[model samples]
Target: MNFRIISALVMRYLFLYSRSPMRLVELAFWPVVDLVVWGNVTVFIQKNTNPEFGSYVLFFLGGMILWDIMFRAQQGVAISFLEDVWTRNLLNIFVAPVRSSEYISATFIVGMLRILITAVVLSFISWFGYAFNVFQLSWWLIPFFLNLMLFGWSLGMISTALILRWGLAAESLAWAIPFFFQPVVAVFYRVEDMPAWSRPIAWCFPPTYIFEGMRDVMKSGTMNWDYLGYAAGLNILYLALAGWLFVWVLNLTRKRGLLTKFATQ
Candidate 1:
């Protein structure tokens, strides 16, 4: 409700990142590594073995861009409280006029902004460098991308609440959850090449649908409504679950006085 307070927090977060731009390089590591390793590997494989693999590489790259957006957004939500714990600024924030709900709202807005910025940067690079033709022409994916971003924000907030409860030990959860999508992404050559049982696990990640959709749109110029609906539905359900979990965790932490238990550390 207090847009001013939320906007202030969002601006502060962006300013901090602007001051220490090197930190972005640290955040950009995973996506760049993905682009380099898989980019060359896919080109090599397709040139020598199967040219079909070339499209797979492009699809995977797009998925990496989306995955990176999710990862960065999660980091924003999960680590927003870390500075307060690490540097003692959180005490001042709590003592300020802002309520917990306002703070939570600020975190969500910042996370979405972070994800959108990353998506734009990655999209520019992919389109020019590799001739990523899928999203270049199809602007319809914007709504789908926004939905995925909302789902990611909800999950990020839940992870942030866990971190607020257990401290830095919960940091691993942020990375671990996103890491599972790596092998399932299109960059991995062939999903069918993997074991039969693993195929189901790979399909479970929403980005798989995203990659498939991008490929279909690029190659066939037709949308895959079935896959899109399934992924969208699953994300909506997960977003609800994530919001519920975040609220529960936040209440528990407040009651237990665990939100600041590790602040002095």
Candidate 2:
């Protein structure tokens, strides 16, 4: 966990983005599009529905923002690794003095920076475009956002591990894997709205509690720490599992001489 090595990796990613305009646009594009499309739909729903239904803008925008936190966090790590793979730089980084933990730490820091930028942009859009103040959610938003980021980072770790083990064939997992948890996360709906069988599975995801908690705040204007606690607990477990899996896969890659093989292909 040397800060110099970690900073070097972070600076490498920063330089990559700085040199590519498309990369910066791509980083902010999907999140803005998601907010615009869904923000308009939320306005439409609010116009037609009763007040008791709560703020559709908040509900929709909150979900989108939180979901993107996880998405950005996951991409921060997984895509950063994939960037190395695409440039055939993975072998070079690992062969250097970089430790596995340092690489991950750097990715996590980069992901946080990305998430912050995206979140700020989307939050302003939600406020001015939709007249929804996400910051109004107050202190509860802190843990909600952190929990989602942790879960996203965990998924990112697993995605990177799979890519390491399976080579380019597993690259799609970088983008597609997070979607697999969407339905189960109950992001846009309540946990009870899910099928009973799915409810059990949904509970396994940390975001389920966060979104449910968001809805609770919208309706009652009260925060539910219980949901946050449950989410935090689940995030810890998932993050630990992800870390172990990443290390195991990395060691296996070295033992099997897959790093060199992957670099060439």
Candidate 3:
């Protein structure tokens, strides 16, 4: 873990984004679009026509903004790895003094930065445009948010591991993997409200507890330490497994000479 190596890798990734305007716009574009559409839709439902939907305002917007945190964080790490593969630059980075651990650390740091920027942008829009302040969830939002990020990074790392092992053909998992868990995580709905069969599956995902805890806070105005603890526990477990899988796959790929295949193709 060389700080200098990590910093160099971070700047290299940042430089790629800086040089491409579309890449920069992409950071905010889809997220803003989601916010506007959902914000307006929820506002519509919260109007005088539907008095019962009043409580849902927080559930919808808050859920969305927080959900995006996980989505974007996952993309940050997974896509950053994909960028190198897309550019045929993986060999260049790995062939240098940068250890695999350093490369992974750099990706996580970059992911954290992207999520922070997007979080601020989405929070601003939710505040002025939708009158939804995410921080109103209180300091509890900190642990919940961090747990989502950890889960997201775990997913991202696993996705990256898949691509490393399967080559470019498996790249779609970088973007597709998160959505698999999306429905089961109960992002916009409650776990118990889901089909009885899905409850076992839903509870396995770390975000499920986070979102459920959020709903509990919204209704009761008190934090549920149990949910936070459960989410944190699950996240740590999954993150450790993700790291192991990535390192294992990297070794397997290297032994099979797939790294050169990735570099050439």
Candidate 4:
């Protein structure tokens, strides 16, 4: 795209947030609550349950920190796009010189930046006071964080495409996506503690590897590169699947004129 057009779209996208600062603050609330409230609850549970429960608490917190990063990365983009629906201004924006790809690119960039900033601040807060440190050197966290965010962003785009094509039932998107990590999160409870049959299901979410890799690095001071590699491979496959689904769904919506039925504007 031309610099002039890109600059204009970027400006419009940035300024859109300026118009609603409360949304940003509201986004901050849940992550902070997770750190403070759940962090304390986990600590309490671990103390009473067993000495090994401490490790479980630590693992659970690590998974949660990463989970929040993934969730918000998706939320940042999905919510931003949905704002257009709420305001009834999406058609006007689309009628501009900006192409669909350009619009998607701008939204993704803004979403990534927002989530990065959020991760840095909250991760730091958790490290100093809450005992949740992912990287000993802190710099090692960059790759892990990037991979999770990209995985989330790809899923976010697919969800946004579906919402645009089907209906703007925002609550459905909110409820469904995070539970995909439920199996992975069960690792905190000790996968073996779960039924033998359920272990395979938990292994499906690639984030389990992501969390396992992070725990290995922080707790053992060595990288689980093999698991990391597995997580990376799964992210690539998921990305392709997400892209294909988005295109197919969008086309189907257009064919049925469902696009207008759920059109943002």
- lDDT values, one for every candidate: 0.68, 0.90, 0.88, 0.70
Please give the distance, in angstroms, between residue 214's alpha carbon in candidate 4 and its true position after superposition.
Answer: 1.6
Q: What is candidate 2's CA lDDT for residue 155? A: 96
Judging by lDDT against the true structure, name the best candidate: 2
Error of 1 at 75 (Å): 2.1
Clashing pairs in 3: none
Report how far residue 116 has shifted in candidate 2, in Å.
0.6
What would the per-residue lDDT of candidate 2 be over residues 117-222, giving only the tens digit for each residue?
8889888988999888888778878888899899999999999999999999999999998999998998898889789999999988899999998878866779
Q: Candidate 2 versus the native: TM-score?
A: 0.97
Question: Candidate 4, residues 86-157: lDDT per residue as tens digits?
Answer: 777777775678665666666667777678767776778788767766556265477677777777777777
Query: If candidate 3 were superposed on the true structure by all CA atoms, what would the RMSD be?
Result: 1.2
Q: Give lDDT tens digits, candidate 3, residues 14-130.
A: 899889988878888988999999999888877855666676766988788888889888988899999998888888887888887898888888888889888999999989998
Candidate 2 worst ten-residue window by lDDT: 51-60
- Per-residue lDDT, model 1, residue 77, is 74
TM of each candidate vs. truth: 0.83, 0.97, 0.96, 0.85
Model 1, residue 194: distance off in Å is 6.0
Query: Which pairs of residues have clashing backbones in candidate 2?
Result: none
Q: Write down the TM-score for model 3.
A: 0.96
